[model samples]
Target chain A: MLDRMKQMQAALDRLPHLRRMGALFSETVLIKVDGQEFYLVFEKGRIAQLLEGPSKKTPYRFSFVTDEDAFEEFWTATPKPGFHDIFAMVKIGRAEIMGDILLLVKNLRFLKEVLALPRARREVVE
Target chain B: MTIEQITGRYLTVEVAGRAQRIYFEEAGQGRPVLCLHTAGSDTRQWRHILNDPAITAENRIIAFDMPWHGKSLPPEGFMQEEYLLSTKAYMETVLAVIGGLELNRPVLAGVSMGGRIALQLAVHHPESFAGFLAIEASDFQPAWYDIDWFHRPDAHGGEMGAALVSTNISPYAPDTERANTLWMFMQSGPGVFRGDLSFYTQDDSLVGQLHRIDTAKTPVHFIVGAYDFTCTPEDARRTAEQVEGATLSVMDEVGHFPMSEYPEAFRPFFVDGLARMPSAGAGAS
Candidate 1:
C-alpha cells in the first residue's frame, strides 16, 4: 500500500498545473490507528514525503479506525442524517486530533479534491 | 487563495439546470474511478483512501461534491425525487467527464449515497464500468426505518442533523479544524437535511435488484464495516448472497466510514480488488 501511494505521488508530480498550484500543500498530517501513527507531507500537490514513528510534527491531525464488519456496514447502509451520528456510533475509539484545526480545515477540501482525481494509467507490464 | 485557485481549475457542470462545482485533480495515467461522497458530506470522505499508496499508484479517481452539497449548488427546484434524478444526472456527467478526459470504462467507487448511485449505474448501464467497489454500501432495506423514532427524536430531523454534523468535529481537533468540517457541512445547507431525509425515508429495495448486476461480466466487490448500525454485516452478507459470485469482505473493528475510520485496513482490500480487475488497462476502445 505504501508503495502504491509513492507511485501515485510520483505520478501527480508530473502534472505541471497541479504541481505548480501546490494542491496537496501541507506541512504534515499525522494519522493514528490503534496506537500507531503515520505522518504525510505534500509538496506541490504530490506526496513529498512520509514518516512512520512514535510521534511527528504537523499543524493538524485526526485518527480513527474500525474493525472489519463495521467498516462494511458504513458503506452499505443508507445515507444517514448527519456526519456525527455516523462517526460516533460507528467509528472505533482509536482516533486523536491535534495541532492547527483551522489549517487542517482550510486544506480539507483541497486534500480531498486531490485524492478524488483519477489514478494514473499504468504501463501495461506484460 | 480563493477556493477555485486553491483546488486548481474548478469545473462547473450543470445537472438538472443547477450549476455544480466539480473539482478535478488529475494524477497518474490510467482508467478513472468516479468517486461519490456520502450524503451531507462532500467529496472529502475520499481523503484517506485517495492518498493511499495503493489507489494513486494504480488507477485514476474522480471525486465530486453531489448536488446541494459541498461547494456545489443545489438544483433550482430541489425535491425528493430530484435526489435520485440528480444521481442519474451525475452518472451521465461522470461518463461525459471520463470521455472528455479520454479514459476508458473506469471502475466506480462510492460510499453511502455514492454507493447507491454506483449501484444504480451498474444495474442500468453495466457496460459503462469495468469494475465496482461499493464500500460499506448495502442493498436498501426497509428494516432500516425500524429504529425507534420517538426515543431517538434526533433520528427524524432538525437538531438530529446538528448532532450528526458535530460528530465529524473531533473534540481533540483544534478549534479551527472542527470549524472547517462544520463549515463544509453547513455550506451544504438545508439541502443536506432534505437529502438525508429522502435517503432515510425512501423505500430503496436495491438489495432486491441484485440480480440485475452482472457479477461475472463486471466484477463487483462489497466492503463493509462489521459493526455498522446502518448497513450491518448481516445486510452486506445478505446482499452478497444475492449477487452470484460477488466478493464480500467484512473488516473487523471498523465502522461505516472505513475510508476515514480505518484507511489502513480498507487500503489492502481496495488495492487487491483493483489489481484483480481484468480490464484494469483496457482504455476506451
Candidate 2:
C-alpha cells in the first residue's frame, strides 16, 4: 500500500496537466480505505502530506471513502464495470464522497485521475 | 485514398411541418443497416464498420447525422429558442429520414442514445425494421451524472463531455480509437449534448412495454460491454430474459462506445448479429 501511494505521488509529480487544473486548489481530503482513515492534505495541486488518521485537528474539505475490495478492484489494470471508476463505484454503492462538492466538481477530472494513478501504467502516466 | 467506398449525401425531409436537410452516408450493396450514434456524437461512430469489407459486403451500412449534429444543419429560425429533444420530435425525425430515403425495412443498429431509441422502436414500431441492435442499452438507465454541467456557461461543454465519456470507456480501447472518441465528442454543438439527453434521461421507461416486442416478427438483440456501469450487462440480461426471442451477450474489455471506442473488438458481434436479422415486413407501425 505504501509503495502504491509512493508510485501515485511520483506519477502525479510528472503530470503537468493535473497540476494546472488544480492550480487554485488547496484543501485536505480525508480518505477512508476499509476501516482505516488517512488525511490527504494538499497545498494547491500538490499533495502536501499523507498523514495517517485518528488525528483530531485535520479538517478536510471533503472525504472519499471506499470498500477495500472495491479499492483493490479499482486498482486493477482493467477493472470490472461497477468497479472500473470512482463515479461508477459511487453509483453502485461501493464508494462514497462526502462534504462540499464544489471543489470536487471543479476538479472532477483531476480528482478522478489522481485517485486512478495506481492503475495508470508508467507508459500512460508520462 | 483517391476514391472511397463510402458515399455521403444530403436529403430533404419534412419534420414538424418544416423542410429539414439531413445528411447520411452509406457503404456496401446488400441489405440496409440504419446506424444511429450516441448523444453528442454523429455518424462517424460507424466509420470502422463501414470500412470493414467483411461486414459491408453483405450489409448496406447507413448512418445519418441527426439535425444539428455532424454535417446535418439546424432548421432556419436562427437561435431564439433552446433545443431540447423530446421523444415525439426524436421519433418524427427518425421516421422522416427512413421514409424520405425509402429504405426497404433496414436493420437498425444503435449505440447509447441510439441504442435506447432502438429499444423504443422495437416496442412501438417493430414491423418498421427487420431487427434492433441495442448496444450498451437496457430498459432504463438514469442519468446519474450532473446534466446541468453539460451546457453550463461556466464549464466547457466539449471538454466535459469528452472527459466524462473517457471515464466510461474501457481502458483496453486502443489509444487512437480513444482519441477519436474524445475528438468526436469535443466537436459537439452548443446545447446539443444536453438536448440529446432530454430524451435519453427523461422520466420515461420501456420496462413494461418490452413485452410487446415480438422477436419472431422483428428480432431484438443486445450487446452490452462489461465495463459500462451505466447500462450494465446485468441490466441487458434482465431485459432479455423477460422478452421471448431476445438475445444478449456481455463483452469483456469493452464499454459504452463499443461501435466507436473499439470497433475492432465490436466487429465480430456486429457481423454475427447482422445475419440474425431477417427482412422487414411491408408496413411500418
Candidate 3:
C-alpha cells in the first residue's frame, strides 16, 4: 500500500495540469485508513510528501478516516456500492471527513485526479 | 434493484424532415414518467431512479438523451462546430421523441436546463404533458462566468469548466457521486456546456410567462437543492408562487444534480415530489 502511495506521487508529478490545479490548494491532508495514517503534503502545485504517520505539530487542513476495505475499494477501477466514494462512505457511517470545506471544493478535480492515479494505472494494466 | 436490472433501447425519430436516433432507458411497469437530463449530461443521471424497484414497480420510467448528447448524435452538418440549444429547437426534438415513442402523456421531469424546458413545455403546450417535476430551474439570470473560459485550449476539454460545475454539487454528497458528476462534465463535447448556458443564463425567460401555465390540465411541482447556488431554493419558491397549483420543496444537503448525486439520498424528495403531483391516469389522453 505504501508502494502504491508512492506510485500515486509519481503519477501526480507527471500530470501536466497538477501545478495549476494545486496552486489553489496547498495543505497537508491526513488520510487515516483504519488507524494507519498517511500525510500528503502539497506545496506549489506538487505533492511534497507521502509520508507514513501523522505530522506531529502541523494541523491537517483536510482529513478522512475509513476502513481498509473502503480504502481499497476507492482505489479500484470499479468499486462496489459502499466503497465507491468518500461522500457515500460518510453517508453509510463507513467513513468520516474533517477539514476546511472551501479548500476541498476549490480543488476537488485536482485532488480527485491525484487520488484516481492508482486506479487509472490498474485499469491500464488489465 | 441494481443498475443491471434496467434495459435500454434506441428510437430513430424524424424532426423537421431530419432523421435522428435518440437513446432512452426504461424500467418497471405502470404510469409513464419521462425524465429529461440537465445540459451536457445524458440519461445516466436517472440510473438510480430506473433501478429502484419501488418506483419501477408502479411507474414505467423513461429517460432519453437529446441530440448531440450521449448516444444521440445530431443530424449531419448541424451542430458540427458549436451546439446552441434554443427553445424552438429543443421543443421540436422533444415533441418528435414523444411522437416517435408514442408515450402516453408521460409525466415530464427534468433538472437544470431540462427543468427550465419542462416549465416552458407546460406553459406553451399544456395538453402535451400530464404533470411536470422541475428540479433546480426557474426564470433567468445574467451569465456569472465567462463562457470563453470553458472553451480555452488550456481548459482540457472542459475539465477546468467542470471545476466550477463541481461546486454546484453539494460538498455533503458522497465522494463517488461527486466524482461521477465531474466525469460527466469532462465527457461533454466542446462548446456544449457553453451552449447550454446560453439557454440557462441568456435565453429561456419565464418571468411574466409563468401565468400562462394551466395547473388544472398540467400541475407543476418544483424540487431545488438547498446547497445549489446557481438555482437557489428561493428561485424555485418565486416561480412556484407565480404559477397556480405549483408546489415548492427544498431538499436538504443536495446541490444541482440531485438525481445523479446520491440517488438513494435523493429518492425520498423525488417520491415526495411525485406525491405532490396529481395522478396521470392510464395513458396520454
Top candidate, metric lDDT: 2
List the pairs of residues colliding in candidate 2: none
Error of 1 at A60 (Å): 41
Tens-place lDDT digits, model 2, residues A54-91: 77788998898887888888988767777877778887
Worst 10 residues of 1 chain B by lDDT: B145-154
Reproduced native contacts, each prediction: 0.15, 0.30, 0.12
Per-model TM-score on C-alpha atoms: 0.57, 0.90, 0.72
Q: Is candidate 1 or candidate 2 better by TM-score?
A: 2
Give the clashing pairs for model 3. A85-B176, A87-B174, A87-B175, A88-B174, B104-B284
Candidate number that wins on lDDT, 1 or 3: 3
Candidate ranking under DockQ, highest first, comes to 2, 3, 1
Interface RMSD of the candidates, in order: 12.7, 1.9, 8.5
| Local accuracy of candidate 3 as per-residue lDDT tens digits, B34-73 | 8999877788888889988898888889999988778887
CAPRI verdict on model 1?
incorrect
Cα error, candidate 3, residue B247 (Å): 0.4
Q: Which tens-of-lDDT digit does each residue in B1-285 have in candidate 2?
A: 557688999999999997889999999877889999999999998888878887788788899999989999988883876888876777788888889988878899988888878888888877668888888887776787766777877766876777777767887788789889888888999889988887778737676888888888888888988878767888788878877889887789898898888888888888778767874343444
